[model samples]
Target chain A: MSEHILETQNLTKEFKGFVAVSNVNLSVKTGHIHALIGPNGAGKSTVFNLVTRFLTATTGKILFEGRDITTTKPADIARLGMVRSFQISAVFPHMSVRENVRVALQRATGSAYHFWKSATSLNELNARADDLLEQVGLLSHADALTVELPYGRKRALELATTLALDPRLMLLDEPTQGMGHEDVGRITDLIRKVSANRTILMVEHNLSVVSRLCDRITVLQRGAVLTEGNYEQVSADPQVRAAYLGGSHAA
Target chain B: MTKIQARNRLYLLLVAIVIGLLAPLVVYPVFLMKILCFALFACAFNLLLGFTGLLSFGHAAFFGGAAYVTGHALSVWGLPFELGILAGTLAATVMGAIVGKLAIRRQGIYFAMVTLALAQLIYFLCLQAPFTGGENGQQGIPRGFALGILDLSNNTTLYYVVLVIFSLGFGLVYRVINSPFGQVLKAVRENEPRAISLGYDTDRVKLTAFIVSSALAGLAGATKAVVFQLASLTDVHWHMSGEVVLMTLLGGVGTLIGPVVGAGVVVTLQNTLSSGPLNAYVPVVLGGIFVVCVLAFRRGIVGEIKALIKQSF
Candidate 1:
């Protein structure tokens, strides 16, 4: 296996003459929890979107496990073991909490196309969903509507659903974006637990979480990587501090 | 589903069967059949609108287009009753595939408009088409003998057949909504981007939903033509499309029996008012009910009842 799970070379995304992500080269090492940090409008999220194929790269090549996936469709990328999470906790609001994870598990079985069969027949997946829910500490809320969950719990549900994919490279866009202090701590621990045998490329605004959890941190400034290093080196760099000096995400 | 809910559904099913069996004895058979046809149409339309979150405003094309084909097959081609209905259904399914392909390219209000435009195209085609006999439509369509034995010429026999077909269609729709595919569809409806991230081909799923809705609507249309012994311009009219939407919304957008109940009420209202002095006010009454539904009871009758029951429990 290659040292890197994913690599984006000269990735660029231009929206109507405005360059959102400019000539960015990013790589995530295998089994490493990597953090992409940047101020608002720094284009960290844009990089995530480009790598996941949610938005087409204006120019560049994205390699996953040494295979080019630059032109692949967004929906097809998940099947290739690179799954992404939305900045918002994107659970099916009307569905039961259990069903949210169950839908993700169904992706593994490829039974999402079976309309004639009873959804109950997929009861076999319920145990796995329960296990996933338990892992995210959402076992108690399994039967409740996802929409009814508190903000923190909903993010937990989103994590469970993402973990259901068992992805080789998990791309989480601001995993704990709108979370409270307790939620941030809980999700940081959850991310550490889930990242044991997988690669994680996370766009996080919280510097504390990044320093604690991420093996490597890449800071973006004005749509390009300003600095890339271990958390200690990146945080200690005077240039990195200067870039974040006036920003709200300063450490 | 919970045990209580399952039990309640069973009770509802038993009651529905009892009512279906005896409805002709009390109500006019033709009128009841009309309600049944529209009920099935609304249910099919609901499958798209409620479950898939696709608002198709051109459903009249499938419903009326199928009626025209079935009428043509039975009247001009002299096909068996079953074959004619199948012909109509297949035609509608094919039409759905074509129209759904185009409509699924857009979403939300645009999707609705595309379907509406396609249905209008079909309407114009039917108007000028020789098989449809222009505005007069294909009339005097022989009901024919079903299965070469059961004489559908008898209104009583026809009613039972229509009932059975409606039951099967409704049951199939119910099964579909409760299926794994249906769950995925609901996910798509709730959040398409999330569903795509889960590796679902949301477009394909939407198209499949559109086709299923169209086929069922066609089945209803074919049955309606045979029951009325005529396929006319009224069946294909844009107003008919609006009527099905009204029925589904009034009954309950996502509820299983909402469309059926809505259809019954609307058809009965039209029937009752057609001969009375209130005929001119029927549209106004329906419009008022729709306004009330949107403003006061956004979930429709069945949806409100469901919420009420859940609260009480």
Candidate 2:
């Protein structure tokens, strides 16, 4: 097995006696695209939240880079090089597309606290932000406010902002939940390009994307791990097909 | 901003400075100073409410609290003019740090209530505090020498001093809202979770904004105390806080020129109505303006104008 960059031990979350996530263990390799998949209310999003420290685990531990970070604040996790993205596009709506990536890059440089200096002085970060936008195929929309971007492009911008952190491991919560087939292809390629150097853990509903992009898959049912395997092994499994794929046979 | 837009803004700034320089010659110097002080106060309030999405209801505590501190320092302690303003501003900064530390623990309306409660506490303390002179307040404060050179006893000299300070404070506010730190604070305002995920300690940013805003508000109040030569209980009253909010809302909460225009209009209305037969209806008229602004022009005066300009250009 390759080295595990992120691992969870009995990660459980409960809300008012409703166990959103229960006794689930997961591991993500250092240089692989791992996926978490489940049916609706399978606690897939909850698992993402738990690992990112957005929600405290009712009873469990999250380990990143071999350090137990179950209690680390959400901001601290990002600083530790484990950053996450929201399921919905979360760009700064009123700011320009270029500015969104610039702000993220500024945060990475520990200069987000420089109020005395003008923001125009941050032109030094423009080339890098431009490069990130180019990576996401948003170089043409740099000057446009994010509110004006099309849905697919907004998601691309969100990805660009995430990329600005140069994170060691990235947690993407439904990176392409709402997108056209063409946009999905674009984002899949983009993800493939970006994932060459870092680990990515994503929760996706599109099984095809999972099959093509993910090296390993973890299936969750009712807040617990049902199975773990490669796409072929997991898709061919009778239990996973009935519980998740609605008994539909995989190609 | 584009080159054309930047040049236009610079032109506007020059025009405003010229107008301010010549304003006292036409209008009463005391009245002009009153408007300038309140304008500065509103801008400071906007730093939190407009830019940071923090609505602090206890700003009167800083405005009036600093007035009292400066009034006492000048009248009772016999300090120089500049030193007294500095003392008062420092006191407000400390208050901002303490109150911000407590209030930032809660957000939205809860944050507003926390600030209001703290301001109320300060109001009571001022009422009972000997230095504040209770209900009568500290009166007849001398206009001490500025820099031990220029005598502020002259109204025109003091008016120019107040104008320069207001200009500096306004410029600083403009600089801050356009700074990188300010951009992060805007990010915090737009989406707290997104800002946190980007590795910004949002609470610390909010606290710093609160302190800077408080200090500037105190500067305005200190100048007012120096101008009027008195610090009254009315300054610290909750009504004063509400008035500043109204001024900001009417001017344009987020627009740079909004508060200044709002202050001028409100101050002019007060001066025009308070002495005339409409004295009893002054509050009613101001209330009417608030209703009209909220119902039809939610962006306030300057924001509406800015939108129009954007459309036209």
Candidate 3:
């Protein structure tokens, strides 16, 4: 069996005259938390966009579970057990938290066209949504409108919704981008808990978060991989230090 | 079970229907039927604009196309009432599919424009078609018996028949808006991108809503042709489309009961004003109402009342 859940060979993306991500090779092993860390304009989000089928790769191939999915639509890719969470909080703001999760569950469970059945009567769907919300510690706010929740709570809701898709691979873009340290710690813990049975490929700017959560880290500079190893190994490497981390740390 | 808040709503509707049925005995049955027809038309329009967040300017296609079909079927081919209505509805469904396929390619203001242009094209087609009697329209349509038993030629019997069909159509609209599909439509209106990311094919949902709305509009139009015993070019005119829109907006855009109330108000206003010398100014009044509704009362009358109720509760 293939160890890689997702693999990209020489993936490249260009917008007009600028190359956002160039000549990148990335592989995420099943049940591993792989973090991609870099400064601004490192094309981390661009790489995510390409992999998720939101943006077509200018050149190269993407393989998921050893099957090529380079030409699949985003929704089709998502249905095939790979889901992504946006960098900015994305949620149905007017819907109650429970409804948001139920919609996703409905999509996952193949009931998208059952119009006559009252959504409230779908006790199984509600129970499943409740369970996922409880997992994210958001069960208390289940009936609250999504717009009313705090920012961190909104992020938690996004995770619950994504989890409702029953994905085998999860792509997270800056999960804790604007969170306070305490909230960051809680979210990091949540990510760790979710990473147990799923492959997680995350683009994180916060070095401490990458150090704490990642099993292996890949450093990128100018859209190319500068180095890849465990945090200590990549952090101390002379070439990675010069290109990305800067010489002060190595000196 | 939980105090049945909708019971009061049921009671109000029952009272209104009773009064409507009794109106012809005291006033005029033909006029009452016309009002009921317009009321149903506005309700159907509201299903798309208020609940689904789609503003269809081509509703005239459904309404007018059904009128022409129902009129021709009743007067020329001599079909029964129910079959005529069904034929009319099928015609609208076909038109809905064609227009929906094209209109859904755009969003917001462009959506309105695309539907409007399509409706205008239909209006011209109706003008040129031989069966429609061209500019003169088909007149003297027979109000045949319901299932060949109800004797719809009798003014009282025909009035009741129209009343029942209108009530059923309105009830179905209410039921659809309260369904899960309706909630998803609201979610799409509130945020399209979020709904898409949540795995909904938003385009499919919108298309379904559009077809349903058009079919119901056809139902209303067919009933009107039977009641008035005429189907004229006026039914398909762009002004008729604007009138239904105005009714929905004045009553309340998103509220379930607003469109019915708006339909009643506009029909009543037009009837009363037509008898006086000021009849020519009805369009100006409608224009003013639209401007006022947009500028000062974006929520419409029903939305305002609901807000007040929420505050009081």
TM-score, one value per model:
0.98, 0.97, 0.90
What are the Cα lDDT values of the candidates? 0.92, 0.92, 0.86
Ranking by TM-score: 1, 2, 3
Clashing pairs in 2: none
The better-scoring model by DockQ among 2 and 3 is: 2
Off by over 4 Å in 1: A247-250
Q: What's the true lDDT of residue B76 in model 2? A: 80
Supply the global lDDT for candidate 3. Answer: 0.86
Q: By summed lDDT, which 10 consecutive residues of candidate 1 chain B come out lowest?
A: B135-144
lDDT of 2 by residue, A23-124 (tens): 999999999999999999999999999998889999988899899999998989999998899988888998899999998999867777787888898889
Tens digits of per-residue lDDT for model 1 on A1-251?
A: 89999999999899999988888899899999999997799998899888888899999999999999999988899989999999988999999999999999997797887888999888999999999999999999899999999998988899899899999999999988888899999999999999988999999988899988999999999898899999889888888887865633455
Model 3: pairs clashing at backbone N, Cα or C within 3 Å: none
**lDDT string, candidate 3, B251-281, tens digits:** 9987878887888888888888888897899
Position A2, candidate 2: lDDT: 39
* Model 1: per-residue Cα lDDT over B153-266, one tens digit each: 888888999999999999989989999999999999999999999888889999999999999999999999999999999999999999999999999999999999899888
Tens-digit lDDT track for model 2 on B1-313? Answer: 8999899999998999899999889989999999999999999999999999999999999999999999999988899999999988999899999999999999999999999999999999999998899989999988889989889989889999999899999998998999998889888888888888988888898999999999999999999999999998888999889999999999999889899999999999999999999999998999999999999999999999999988997
Runs of candidate 2 exceeding 4 Å displacement: A248-251
